[model samples]
Target: MAINSGSDPMRFSASIKVVLKDGVLDPQGETIGRALKDLGFESIVSASSGRIFRLDIDAETEAQARKIAGEAASKLLANPVIERYEVEMAK
Candidate 1:
């Protein structure tokens, strides 16, 4: 949790990194990387794709912001069995 003080209402931005759980194959990322190589884009050696979500929320406190973001992750952003999520918040 973070605390911010100023005249303006506090704003929190969250960055979420969603990745395939260890042992889960990222075939889509691999396939895209392979395709890029085939098309002569040799600069791309590998691809590990993931999802990112940027959110804007208003909360009286940073703890509340974190709690809300956590609930969102558990309910919608992440697949419990095959995906894991990391959350970062800025104020």
Candidate 2:
């Protein structure tokens, strides 16, 4: 049997962007925005599609946390060929 307890000590949060590179165009975002406008969603001034992830880590130091985050971004989060990452740590 598995317990349903939700208590945990690790805490982390990340804001990730998988945008088109400087020379690339984001057709998906543009298309979505246009669709929204067509649907009478005038309140949406602008739209950009991206991903956000929340993680829980065991790192006790900022350096360790950054290292872990960098690994995650490189491995799964951002496409290295067309994207870059910026990591910020909570104090």
Candidate 3:
């Protein structure tokens, strides 16, 4: 496969947040919430577990960088079945 290195390359950073889709059971999150409650943090309502990925890519524009990062998240970082991912550009 050929790589596209734009003539005017700018480094961009992206953050990918992978989380369980709503209505999906998260055993780890439940455990954490319970633990927090047991630790005397009674005000805690709920907790959920998720994964974050930080990636840096060379692109010509912010849109291109976001597309690359989003593709990576969809194809490898996140499972489409029970999980969803959100991509954001880092400042």
Report per-prediction Cα RMSD to one decimal. Answer: 4.8, 7.9, 3.6
| Per-candidate clash tally | 0, 0, 0
Ranking the candidates on TM-score from highest down gives 3, 1, 2
Worst 10 residues of 2 by lDDT: 7-16
Measured by TM-score, the strongest candidate is: 3
lDDT of 2 by residue, 1-91 (tens): 4474454435555444455566556777789999999999999986667665655566545577777887897899888887776666655
Question: What lDDT does model 2 reach?
Answer: 0.69
Tell me the deviation in Å of residue 1 in model 2: 39
Candidate 2 has which clashing residue pairs, if any? none
Tell me the TM-score of model 3: 0.91
Q: Which ranges of candidate 1 are over 4 A from the true structure?
A: 1-9
lDDT of 1: 0.84
Global CA lDDT computed for model 3: 0.95
By TM-score, the better pick of 2 and 3 is 3
The lDDT of each candidate is 0.84, 0.69, 0.95
lDDT, ranked from best to worst: 3, 1, 2
lDDT of 3 by residue, 1-91 (tens): 4476446799999999999999999999999999999999999999999999999999889999999999999999999999999999987
Cα deviation of 60 in candidate 3 (Å)? 0.8
